[model samples]
Target: MTEPLIELKGVSKSFGRHKVLDNVDLTIYRGEALGIIGPSGTGKSTILRVIAGLLSPDEGEIYVQGVRRDGLIEDGGQEVGIGMVFQQAALFDSLTVEENVGFLLYQNSNLPRSRIQDLVKEKLDMVGLPEVGHLYPAELSGGMRKRVSFARAIMSNPDDPTVGPEVLLYDEPTAGLDPIASTVIEDLIRYLQCLHGVCSTYAVVTHQDSTMRRTADRLIFLYEGRVQWQGTVSETYNTENPLIKQFLSGSVQGPIQVAG
Candidate 1:
C-alpha cells in the first residue's frame, strides 16, 4: 500500500486523571476517506484534535508526510496541509459568512479585498450555499452553518496552493441535523471529496451509521480509547467482531457497556 499521508504512532492522551486515548496508532492514506466511530467519551474527536495539532499527545509521535510534528513550533498543518471542520460549526458570530470564509486569506495572504471576496463567493457556491454570503452564523440554520464551515475549510487562493488543506479532518459533520439534513450533509461530504476538487484526504468522526457508510470507504471502530476493529465500510455490517456487531446492531448487551 502507499505510505500513509498522516500517521500516529503510539499516541496517548489524558485529561487530568481520565485517559482519553491509549497507545493508539492510526494511518491515513492520500485521497482516502476514513470514518472514526465509537461510543461517547471514546476519544474519537480527540484523535482528530491531536492530528489537527490543536492538542499535543502526552506520549506518542505524529508524522505528517513523513515528518515528525513533535518539534514543530507551530501547528503541524504547514507541513501536511491539514484543515478541520469542527462538530459545533465553530463560526464567528460577529462575522458574515463571506468574512468567515475568507478570514484566513484576509489575515494571512497578500490577496486584495476584491479577490478575497470573489474567492469566498466561489467557495460558498461550491458548498451549495450560494448567495448566503451576506448572512451571519446566527442568521443561518444549523445545516447552513455547517456548510459555511465546510466552505471555510476549503477556502484557498489557488495562486498559492500552500494555503489549502490537503488533509481534511471532520468532527461529526452530520451531528445534530435531522435525518433529511443529515443526508444532505452526508451527500455533500461525498460531493466535496469526489467533485469539489478541494482536499485530498478526509477523516470523519460521526455517530450516524448512514454518515459513516456513505462517507467513508474504510472505518476504524474506536472503543475504550483504542481501535477495536478496522475494516472496509461494507465489512462493517457483516463483521462478526463483537464490538462491531454491538455497535452496528445498537445492542445494549455486548462488550460495550452503558455507564450508569
Candidate 2:
C-alpha cells in the first residue's frame, strides 16, 4: 500500500466535557477513496473539520506527508492543497457562483482577475455546470449548490496546479439532494479523484449508503466516538459486526441506541 498522505493517531476531541472523538486513529493513502459513516453527531463532520485544519483535537497528533498539522484552526486551506466541501455547500450568499468558486484565488493569488474568471469557468465546466458561475446560491437548486461547492473544492487545484491542494475532504456531499442528483455528486467525486492523479487523498464523511458505496473504495465506520469497524465497501455489506450490520440494515434493534 502507498504511504499515508494524511494520518491521525490517538486523535480525540471534545466540547467542554462532551467528547466528540475518542482516541480515534485513521489514515488515508494517496489517491484512495475512504468514506466515513456513522450515526448523527457521531463526530463525522468533526473529522472533516480536523482534516481540513478547521478544528484542533485536544489530544493525539495529525500528520500530512509525515509533517504534523499546525495552525489548523486559523486557516481553512493549505499552500500545498487540502480542499474541503462543507455540508451546506457553504456558498457565500453575497457572491456569485464564479466569485464563490474563485474566492480563494482572489484572496491568495497574484493572478489577474481575468485569469481567475477563466479558472472558474473551467471548474464549472468540469462539473457539467458551465453556465452557472454567474448565478447566485439563492438562484440555484440544492443540487446545483452542491455542484458549486464541489466545483470550488476541486477547481483551485486543477486551475493552478501550483497553488492547488493535494488532499480533498467532503462533509456530506450528498446531504440534501434527490437520488439522481446524489448519484451525480458521487460520479463527480470519483471523477475528480481520477482526474487529479495520485497526489490526492480523499476522506468523505457521509451516512448515505449509496454515497458510501459509490465513493469509497474503503469504508470506515465510526460509532459512539470510536472507530467500530473498517473495511472495504463490499465487506461492509456482509460484515457480521453488530454495529455495522445495524447501520447497513438501518435497524434499531442492534447495539446502537437512538437518543431522543
Candidate 3:
C-alpha cells in the first residue's frame, strides 16, 4: 500500500456546547483522491480543517508523514505542506488576481517582483486564466474565482520547491456554480492532479453529487460527527446502505433525518 500522508487517530472536536467531531479516525494516503460527504452540519468541513492543521482536534493526534504534529500549523516544523481551498473562494476583494494568487510569495519570499509575476502568470495559465491577473475578484465569475483560488493553493516558491503543498483540502469546490461551470471545475481538478509537480493527493468535502463522483476515488460518508460508511464510487451507487441510498436519492424517508 502507499504510505499514509495524513492520519487522524481517535480525533474529536467540539464548538461551545456542540460536538462537531466525535472520536473520528481517518487516513489519507499519498497520491489518492478522497471525498468526505454527508448531510449539512455533519462536520465534513471541520474534518478538513483538522486535517489541514488549521484547527487542532480537541482530543486526538494528527500524524503527517508518520510524524505526530505538536501544535497548529503556525507552530512550524511540519514535514509536509498542506493547502486549503475554502468553499467561498475566499479571495481578498481589494487584491488583484495577480496579487491574490501570489500573495504569499510577495509577502514572505525575497523573490524579485518580476519573478513573482512570472510565477503568478504560470499558475494562472495552469488554471486557464492567464489574462485575468489584472482583474479583481469582484470582476470574475464564481467559477473563475474558484479557479483563481486553485492557482493560489498550488502556488509554490521557486526557491524552495519543498514549500509547495503535498496535499490539498478542498471545501465544496463546485458549490453554487451552474452545472456547466461545475463540470469545468471538476475537469480542472482532474487536470491539475495529472500535472507533474501539482498535488496528486487531496481531500474534498462537498455536497455536490457530480463533484463527488468525478473528483474522488474513495468516499467516506459522515453523519452525526462519525463516519458511517466508506467505499469506492462504484460501491456508492450499488450498495444497499440506507444512508448512502437516501443521500444519493435525496429522499426524506431513510435513516438520515431531514434538517428541517
Candidate 4:
C-alpha cells in the first residue's frame, strides 16, 4: 500500500455504556477508496466521525499524515484538511444553494461574494449541478440535494489552498436514496476521486450493497465495535467469512445475530 494518510491505533469510543469502537486499529492510505460496511448500529458512522476529527476517540491515537491529533478538529493541529458529507444532506433551508456551498468562505474568509460565487460555481459544476445554485434545498430531489452537499464538502478557499480537504469522510451518503439515486451518488464518489484538485482519498460508510461495490476498491466489515474482516471488493464475494456471507446474502441464520 502507499504511504498511510491516516492511522487509528487502538481506538475506542463509547457513549455511556454503549461502546461504538473497541480498540480498533485501521489505516487509510493515500489515494485509496475505502468502504466501511456493516449492519445497522455497528459503529460505521462513528468511525467516520472519528476519522474526520469531529469526535475524539476515548482511548487511542489518531495520526493524520503522521502527526498525532491531540483534540477535536476545532483544536487545530491537524496537518491535512478533512471534510465530511453527512447522510442527511445537511443544508440550510433558508439559504440558496450558492450560499450553502460557500458558507465556509463567507464565514471564515475575506473573499467577496462574487469570488465566492464563482468558486461555488466551479464546485457545483464538478458535481453536475451547475444550474441549481439559485435553488433552495427543498427545490431539488434527494439526489440533487446530496450532490449539493458534495459541492459543499469539496468547496475550498482559494487563498488557502492547503486548507482544502485532502481526505473526505462520507457517512451513509446513499442512505435514503433509491437505487438509481444511489448509483448517481456512487458514480460521483468515484468521479470526485479522479477529478483534479479534489479529494482523492475518501472513506465511505455505507450499508447499501451497490454503493459499496461501485465506490470502494477496498472493503472493511465492522461488527460489534471491531473490524471483523478486510479485503478487496472481489475478495468480498469469494471469502467464506461467516459475517461477510451473512451480510452479503442478507441471511439471518448465519453468525450475525439479527437485531430484534
Candidate 5:
C-alpha cells in the first residue's frame, strides 16, 4: 500500500470559543484527487489551511510525506511542498498575469527573468489561458482569474526544485461562476494536475456538485466540524446516510438545522 502523502491525526481547531474543527483525521495519498464537501462553516477551508501550514491546529499532528513540521514554515523549508488556491482567486491586482504567475520565482529565486517568463507562458498555456499573460487581473473575467490563480499556485522556482509543491489544496475553486465557466474550471483543474507532475496529491473544498463529481476520486463529507462520512464519488450518490442525503437534496428539513 502507498503511504499517504499528507496526514492529519486527531486534529482540532478553534477560533476564540467557536470550535471549527474537531478531531478530524484525514489521509491524502499520492496521485489521487480528494474532495472535501459539506455545508458552510463546516471547516472545509480550515482543513486546507492546516494542510498548507497557513493555520496550525491547536491539537493534533500534521505529517507531510511522513515527516512532522513545526509552526509556520520558515523560508527555504520545502519538505511539505504545499500549495493553496484561495476561494476568491487572490491575485495581485496591480501585476500583469505573467507577473502574477511568476511572482514567487522572480522574487525568491535566482532564475533569469527570461526563463521565468518562459515558465509562466507554459503554465498559462497549460491552463488554457495562453497569450493572456500581458493582461491584468481586472481585465479578465472571474473564471480567468481562477485559472490564473491555479497557475500561480503551481508555479515553482526552477532554481530551487524543492519549492515546487507536492500537494495542492484548493478552497472553493468553482465559486461565483456560471455553470459553463464552472465546468471550464473543473476541466482545467484536472488538466493542470496531469500536466504538473510535481504535485502528486490534491484536495479540494467545494460545494459545487458537478465540480465534486468530476474532479474528486474520493469524497469526504464534513459536517459540524467532523468528517461525518467518506467514500468514493459514486458512493456519494448512493449513500443512505442522512447528512449525505440532506446535502444532496439541499433540503431545509433534515437532521442538519440551519442557524436562525
Candidate 6:
C-alpha cells in the first residue's frame, strides 16, 4: 500500500476551556479526494488548520508522507510546500491577480521576469481565470477570488522534481455560492487535483448537502469534537446512526439534542 500522504495521531486541541478536538486520529492516502461533513462549529475547519500548521494540536503528532515535521517546517531554513484555499479568498488588496500568484516566485526563483510571467499566465489559465490576472481582488467576483487563491497557493511548486503543492487543503470551498457556481468550484477542485498530480486534497467542507454529495469520495461525520462515524457518501444516505440520520434528514426531532 502507498503510505498515507498525511496522518494525524491522537490529535487534540482546545480554545481556553472549550475543548474543540479530543484524541482525533485520521489518515489520508495519495491522490484521493476526501470530504468532511458535519454540523456547525464541529472543528472541521480546525482539522484543516492543524494539518496546515496554522494551528498546532495540544497533543498528538502530525506526519506528512510518513515523516515527522518540526513546527512550521524548515530544512536548511526554507518554507515547505502546501496549497490552501480559504473560505474567504484572503487575497492581498493591493496586489493584482498575476502579482499575487507570482509573488513567491519573484522573491525565491532566480528565473527571469518573462519566464515568471509566462508561468503565472499558465497557472491562471489552469484555474480558468486567464483574463483576470491583471485584475485586483476587489474587481473580481467571489468565485473569481477563490480561484485566485487556488492559483497562488499552487504557484510556487515548492517541492522540486514535482511541479506543485504536495497537499491541497480547502476550507469550505462551496460556501455562499449558488448551486451552479458551487458545482463549478467543485469541478475545479477535482480538476486541479488531477491536473497537477496532487498527492492528496483534504477538504473541510461545511454542512452543505449538494456540495458534499457532489464532491466527496469518503465522508467523515464530525459531531461534538469527535468523528462519530465515517463511510462513503452513499452510506451517509442510509446510515441508521441517529446523529447522521438526523443531520442528513434535516430533522430537528431526533437523538441530537439541540441546545435551547
For each candidate, the alpha-carbon lDDT, in order, equals 0.90, 0.85, 0.94, 0.93, 0.89, 0.79
lDDT of 4 by residue, 89-159 (tens): 89999999999999999998999999999999999999999899899999999999999999999989889
RMSD of 5: 1.3
Off by over 4 Å in 3: none
What are the per-model C-alpha RMSD values against the true structure? 1.5, 2.1, 0.8, 0.8, 1.3, 2.4
Best first by TM-score, ranked: 3, 4, 5, 1, 2, 6
TM-score of each: 0.96, 0.94, 0.99, 0.98, 0.96, 0.91
lDDT winner: 3
Displacement of the residue 249 alpha carbon in candidate 3, Å: 0.5
| Candidate 2, 1-260: lDDT as tens digits | 79888889999999988899999999989778899999998999888888777888899998887888776735534445778888999999999999999998899888889998998998898888999987899999998999898888875634466566577899999998889999999998888878744235688998888898899999999988899899999999988899988887888897899776
Q: Please give the clash total of every predicted structure, in order.
A: 0, 2, 0, 0, 0, 0
Candidate 1 lDDT by residue in tens digits, 130-189: 899998899999999999999999888778877888888999999899999998898888
Q: Cα deviation in Å at residue 122, candidate 5?
A: 1.0
Q: Write the per-residue lDDT of candidate 5 for residues 151-183, one digit (tens) a residue.
A: 998898766768878788989999999999999
**Sort order, lDDT high to low:** 3, 4, 1, 5, 2, 6
Cα lDDT of model 3 by residue, 1-260, tens digit: 59998999999999999999999999999999999999999999999989988898999999999999988988989978898999999999999999999998988899999999999999999999989999999999999999999999999997987678989899999999999999999999889888998898999998998999899999999999999999999999999999999999999999999977
Candidate 5 versus the native: TM-score? 0.96
Residue 256's C-alpha lDDT in candidate 5? Answer: 89
Q: Count steric clashes of candidate 4.
A: 0
* lDDT at 149, model 6: 85
RMSD after Cα superposition, model 1: 1.5
> Using alpha carbons, what is the TM-score of model 3?
0.99
